[model samples]
Target: MHEWALAEGVIKTIKEYSKDKKIEKVVVKIGELQQIDIDIFKFALDELKKENSMNKLSIILEIEPAVLKCRVCGKTWSFSENLKELDDFIAESIHFVPEVFHAFIKCPNCGSPDIDILKGRGVWIEKIKFKGE
Candidate 1:
């Protein structure tokens, strides 16, 4: 699934970037809008790491809140505040394609459909620590 793919991507990226260096720790940031299953992602990472012979590597994941800004009113709000309004189908859609959020969500303050995603849209590596300084 996507989680597995994402895990593989992380491993591949680390391997490519840290060539010949042993990785000590990797800090990855997960955007809430992606709706990734943290437990599954971690498991995938562990399995993939082992397969890649990265046994000593430590992976850390951080969840970032999805923030949206109203284009009309300039008000910012957290996605969590509007989660209760989303149906299962819509949630699933956003999970796979976050851009779909624009169709389902609106500015909370101004009730405007014009909104901008301020943060928490994708996954990325925040920091990487090698085995030695």
Candidate 2:
């Protein structure tokens, strides 16, 4: 729910920029670490653009992993790699309904939980393709 509130503002900005030009699609570069629910963001966009069909640009997410960098060894790793157990556990708990993997960052190289975040930290509008000219 809190994520939704933050996303509403993003949607507003996206739409405002596309006010003059008819948008073809909206491309969002979301860092894997942001942990945003894509479903919620899409739903919000769909609802908001229901009125203006041309303004209704489809949501395209460029999902990058929220990665951590090892300060000691200078290695980079993704949090997704560490979620195998959690993913399996969720599926088993849900009776094999097919679930997605979710994991936390804990550096394997140095075994340090204090690794620096290298990428995938925030949500950004990378580019917006529009039907102009």
Candidate 3:
């Protein structure tokens, strides 16, 4: 059901962008921190696309790695490196609200709580391929 809500939001954005234009394809980037099930998300997209009259629209999904930067030490690290340290509940917290990462994670280099998300936080439309070029 959560995936359905996300899919609905995506469809709404596509609808706005495709106003009076034919969309050949949409490339979506999914962030790892979101913890989205790709297959479920795709299924939701397909169902929503048909409901929104976008049956012809092609959707391409790309998964991006989560990267975090330490604001204090200027060191960058991959989120996956620390994933094993987190329990299921903590991971779920980050999945629902990425901003809460600061509450549970600290900089690996300097042990500072001040960190910046470099990439892979949420899903977004990366590129839209339109018909007829």
Question: Who wins the TM-score comparison?
Answer: 3
The TM-scores, one per candidate, come to: 0.93, 0.66, 0.95
User: Residue 23 lDDT in model 2?
Assistant: 73
Best by lDDT: 1
Give stretches of model 3 more than 4 Å off. none
Model 2 residue 109 lDDT?
79
Say which prediction, candidate 2 or candidate 3, comes out ahead on TM-score: 3
Query: How large is the C-alpha RMSD of every model relative to the true structure?
Result: 1.2, 6.6, 1.0
Would you list the rank order by TM-score, best first? 3, 1, 2
Name model 1 segments beyond 4 Å from true. Answer: none
- What digit string (tens of lDDT, one per residue) describes model 2 on residues 24-123? 7777887765556778766766665664453546778788776767787788877667545445455343222211222234567777655776777667
What is the alpha-carbon lDDT of model 2 when measured against the actual structure?
0.62
Q: lDDT per residue, candidate 3, 1-133, as tens digits?
A: 5777888888999999888999998999999878888889999999998888889889999999999999888999999987889989898888777787889999988899999999998888999888998
- Per-residue lDDT, model 2, residue 14, is 74
Instruction: Assess each prediction's global lDDT (C-alpha) against the native.
Output: 0.90, 0.62, 0.89
For 1-133, candidate 1 gives per-residue lDDT tens digits of 7789989999999999998877899999999988899999999999998999988889999999999999899999999888888999999998888899989898877799998888898789999998776
- For model 2, the superposed segments whose C-alpha errors exceed 4 Å read 51-55, 84-106
